[model samples]
Target: MKNLNRKNAIVMGIGLLMLSVAQIAAHYNPNMPDSYKGFFMGTGLGIMILGLIKNKPKRAS
Candidate 1:
């Protein structure tokens, strides 16, 4: 909770959401275009990485 914040939560939520959506789409509908799938995975991973960075606790200077 300490490291969690509004922005981080939002980013993590959206990132994970996209990933989940992508997964479900692929599982439920296997005929999806490869380009969109790659885009979803790429953006999702990038956003989650950003969330991880934002969620890290910073040392007080």
Candidate 2:
């Protein structure tokens, strides 16, 4: 249980970090291509989903 919690925390932290980086990149590069922005958005969302999955409780048999 403790290990699961720790893994979840790390996953969430990484997702937050990626989101911050994406935001900063968008802010600094106003002329960034749509494809680049789309890629970042997709990646950030994927990380967040992974974090959510990590935090989900396992069913007991």
Candidate 3:
């Protein structure tokens, strides 16, 4: 928790939202395509990776 900052938090939040949408759509909408769910899942994972990468502490060169 201490390592998390505002920017990282926002990015993670967005990723979480995307994942939630995918989950909800999976259960509620039979008409929703698998491709859309895959897209959201992939995008959410990518966003979280980016956030984690950005959250890494820089070392002095």
In candidate 2, what are the lDDT values of residues 5-59, reduced to their tens digit? 8777777777777778777888899998877877877787788788777687888
**For model 1, how many clashes?**
0
Model 2 lDDT, residue 45, Cα = 75
In model 1, the runs with Cα more than 4 Å from the true position are 56-61
- In angstroms, the error of model 1 at 24 is 0.9
Please report the TM-score between candidate 1 and the true structure: 0.75
Cα-based lDDT at residue 48, candidate 2: 73
Question: Candidate 2 vs candidate 3: which has greater lDDT?
Answer: 3
- Model 1, 1-61: lDDT tens per residue? 6658899989988999999889889888889998888899889989988988878777899
Which residue pairs in model 3 clash with each other?
none
TM-score of each model, in listed order: 0.75, 0.72, 0.85
The local lDDT score (0 to 100) that residue 57 gets in candidate 1 is 76
Candidate 3 local Cα displacement, residue 41, angstroms: 0.9
Every candidate's CA RMSD: 2.0, 3.0, 1.4
> Highest TM-score, which number?
3
Q: lDDT by residue for model 3 over 1-61, one digit each (tens)?
A: 6879899989989998899989998889988899999999999989988888899877999
For candidate 2, the lDDT comes to 0.78
TM-score: the better of candidates 2 and 3: 3
